[model samples]
Target: MPDGQSTRTAMFRVKNLWIIHLLGWVLFMSLPLTIVSREPSAGFPVRILQSGWFSSFFLVYATLFYGNLLVLVPKLYLKQHYVAYAAVFVGLLVAIYFSKPFERLIFRNFRQEQGRELRPEPPREGFREGRPPRPPHGGDARPMPRPNGERAVDFVSLTLFIVVWAVAMAIRISREWRQSERRAILSEAEKAHAELSFFKAQINPHFLFNTLNNIYALAVSSSAHTAPSILKLSQMMRYITEEATENYVPLEDELACLENYVELQKLRLNAKTSLDYEVKGQPEGIRIAPLILMTFVENAFKYGVSNHRESVIRIAVEVAGGDIRFLCQNRIIERNREEERTGVGILNTQKRLDLLYSGFYDFDIHNDGEIFTVKLKLPGR
Candidate 1:
């Protein structure tokens, strides 16, 4: 089935073809009389005009049989039958050439046209002594055979045929151009979706492994706070398992993950350690990519707070001016002199953010004295 565009294109193609053919037919059949006449005498102009008018009268009839055959091809033959097409085409050509103006009263007042298949009154040749037949109705008498003039007709009509074919070819080209553009857009979307899915895969596994490691550490210590640590870890897992499937989670869900992570870390806090945090966003309806915020919080616990004797952790996040602004700072108490700085977790988290919010984020990392900070600003209304 054709869509709206294809249907419209097809209709235009049909109209264009006929317009080309009609213009060509008029120009060619009228040319000798209307434009190319070598006549200096009025009589020649009148004769050409009569012939041109005669040919113009049968234009549609000629198209009904011949033009349709050219366009519809063998379909026309199958419908009208091959013999019928040939017979009508040949008979019409012969009639245009040989039909007598007054041939209707020769054989007992019954005069008919003459052709290979037509029978008219036998020629009255001065009653067989070389006179042209007395055409019926006694209006005139003439004897002549008009040639097909096939070369002239072919030169004119085939030129019009080529124009029609060119228009159809143009329609096909335009349709393909549109289809190609649509395909290009779809391909670009698929590329983006694949990039996002890879980012998701990279971040999720890194997150789960880190959380499991925290659980392992608590399990090894076997402190009185172990049960609640296990509970917090379980809640974090629930958040991951449920919310990770979604494209975006509520901003509060991200805040809750950070809180759970902080609670679990509290079970292991040294007496000198301190944590400071604030969340001022409208957490109810605001949405964020799943697990986006926790990476900074987790980094605070993993690098700065985990290594310090009396470390400081500070977090501030709020929706300001239609933006989600996040900041995390912790003391980098134990800097390593010789080690790779790009951990798998941090690297994966960076990629996930790049995919999710390509230009919508501002991420900065800085270490001032003993404090390390990850500052992020993202946009959502």
Candidate 2:
């Protein structure tokens, strides 16, 4: 679900798909090499050699097919050079058509040479007598009649050339479509990240001001906890400055940041407010969006804590089987219940989860009269 991983996966899939395409073409091409004729004059190996000669011509067609995909599509059609694209494509097709007969001539010459090599004439029977060899009945060896298979080679080559051209064009077009869609998705995600960053930037200043105020009060009161509180605040600030801008951070680091924030909040909250936090499993090698859980924790502190009334906030995180589950529950202050739904922090968190996890996670929130709860489940590691 991280940003670059999806792009790499898509590229891998496309590469595999094209490999399958090439293998299918190769299997189809082998038919000509294996199958000779029902009329049984030449052996299959001889036919295969003949087909190999024809295959050499198909090699040129294959080159053109791949060339059009890798070169022509990008340089001409995709670049909006429509007239040039049309002219070049038609020219290639015509050249392939004409080259078929040219190659057939070459195959015929090869067959003639092979025939001479394979079937030398027996010693002339009449040479022993004095009649030089009454020429064959009607004429000297008329060119051996071409086989039906050899005659069909040119037509079949042309047909395959056309078919391959069409297939290459189709694949190129589909690949372009997939690339464009990927670009659009990435663009939308970048826009969302920019907007979310701006919102988060706004949140940091306000949160720092509030935490500084709490620290100031503790310092003025000369409480012994002031030094450690300032140290905690420094650590949290360092984390926000260094790690928060990245796409993801170690889950344990994020949880440590939360612990620091909670400790700082404890310096300001009444002793009567009950806050319970627990971690249920190991967090090694796991990662999550930075500060994603802090919003809910901050909300709980902001609205659920009271100096006079007994208030409770509980947070728990569970990690198991490559899944992470987070739960935060707090009893709300009677008067602040209505305003809970509105905050830049909560809204930004929702947008981020949608962009990053989309189909890979579940998020839920509920306000049941007296208690507000948030639950998040997402893939880990």
Candidate 3:
């Protein structure tokens, strides 16, 4: 396998084992030195050269064991810090017990067998050849295993093992922390999606309520076009309820909705008030979020039509290929706080735009003391 693939596979497989791995590595790294470092003064580092891939057996098993302990320790006994520490301490002893017996066997047996293979050659510095080695008693002529400083190695191995365990546990703990953060971000997104759906649902009832009220007024006034009003309303209602739920709706359908809404509003208003609606750039089939433009439309009608004064609502939409621009401007009446406060509905609409468009939208809201203006330009990617 390639290096990256091998590392990834090892990471997945070893993320769960613990103590058994610690014992295995301690034995693997130490065994070669004990066995093959026979003639320690022979000027050859046989422990390393001869260790070979057999050492990897030790590496894989030992790392896995240490990793397992890290996960299991914190998961099962986190609140009981003292007990977890105790279990670790006991596990250490058992690991050494199973692993220590190998040191003596590795050194003593491999060398003894190897020495016998090339016997009677007076093996040199290791056993003190010929007359045997000293015993502080002067009564033997047999070759014996040389002193390879086993006690010193015992201290070194134990110290190194403790250090390895500490480092391995830290890695596992850090990985756990990152996984938790990913889960938290996903949960927040789900909540925002639900909130957007709820806000989107509110627009339907508000639009219906206002439109029905206008139709009722026309009926009472006995206008000649009441039938046309009801028919326009049916079309608008069907268009909104059936199509707006989709991700995007044709710009023409949305404009038709706005036109129907304007016609409905005109029935209540006298002919002197002004409204300008324009579509520049042949923006017929361009798509947009359902009802994204409706809030601005409703706001314009609510505040722009003066009962007996000159008032204007100007709305213009321009679409060209992948770009769309919508501009809504209304006269700002200083004394009408209720109509101005209804402007807060724009906040919910702005939030939806942020979620859906992100980098693709430019929205500007400004009031130059007389005119309240909103400009939004969105580009498709």
Candidate 4:
């Protein structure tokens, strides 16, 4: 889905959930009072008007409900301000107690109104001798007797309040935990990307230093192939500087880069050295991390080439069945003692593969007596 549309859908669902909670609370408070009362079968609306707990209980409960959800839990409880949270909680309870008289007054009036409407009195008679006067008819009947205000401070309300508070806290904490996890994941991804970029940036200087040395040797020897080699190097450098910085590049571009390096090396190697290169399958639309294959090819030229004996360098790239395979091998005519030091390019490639492909790629290196080989397989991008 488009991001905007998905976000809007999510918001709509949240709104519906809020509406459901509100309706559910209303029914929860009103249903029992309607069912258990002895009054005649009044419609739901009339019953709600006469209901004892619905009016002020709902008011007080709702006040605390949202207060805890929006304020108390987030600002105090979640912050581990337990003492302050408890103080505020106790204050709300005490306020509920002090609010009892008003709730009773409202309940008494409602009941009286319902009573008068439902049950009218017969004509009143004069008081009997030695008896107090009878209470007046409907207009002035004594209000329903006030029940004990202390009854308001019972276990049921307290338990229900606790349940609501628990729910609010649970919801708030879960949301915070999820948000924290998302932030952590995002942070990790950004850090990995920055590291990969650093690795890529280091490759150009490292590879360029080696290539420049080869160019200097060719320039010193005054080889006729020197100009073309320099041209190829320039093109390769342009590609690296311009396109290699991207997260991915066309697979063909990397293959071209490898070809340039191979041709440059050919100009500097002895005629006895034989080099074989092959590419199979289309590279169209396929993208790969840049400079990933260059290190092994550079290693082949650096330590695998010798003028004293017949040397062979083999490089192949294949793309088929939604996978890419790269292989490079060279006969070890004479190893350069200086090549014992592993270059930074190889280490950078390892780190880049881990950051970008993780377990999705295969990298293998084998060195036996006569030959050194490298093979890499990657899933299609």
Q: What are the lDDT scores of the predictions, listed in order? A: 0.64, 0.78, 0.71, 0.78
lDDT of 1 by residue, 116-228 (tens): 22556675545655554467788755645444212223333333334443454354446557888999989977876787677667667777777677678877878677787
Question: Ten residues in a row with the worst lDDT in model 4?
Answer: 101-110
Off by over 4 Å in 1: 1-174, 306-310, 333-343, 367-371
Superior candidate under TM-score, 1 versus 4: 4
Displacement of the residue 158 alpha carbon in candidate 4, Å: 1.8
The sequence of per-residue lDDT tens digits that candidate 2 reaches over residues 115-193 is: 6656666877666654456567757744556563355346655666677777878889999999999999999978978
Error of 3 at 173 (Å): 3.9
Better of 1 and 2 by TM-score: 2
Global Cα RMSD, each model: 13.0, 7.2, 7.4, 5.8
Residue 121, candidate 2: Cα error in Å is 12
State how far residue 301 of model 1 sits from its true place (Å). Answer: 1.7
Which structure among the candidates has the greatest TM-score?
4
C-alpha TM-scores of all predictions: 0.54, 0.63, 0.69, 0.77
Model 3 weakest 10-residue run by lDDT: 43-52
Model 3, 344: alpha-carbon shift in Å? 6.5
Clashing pairs in 2: none
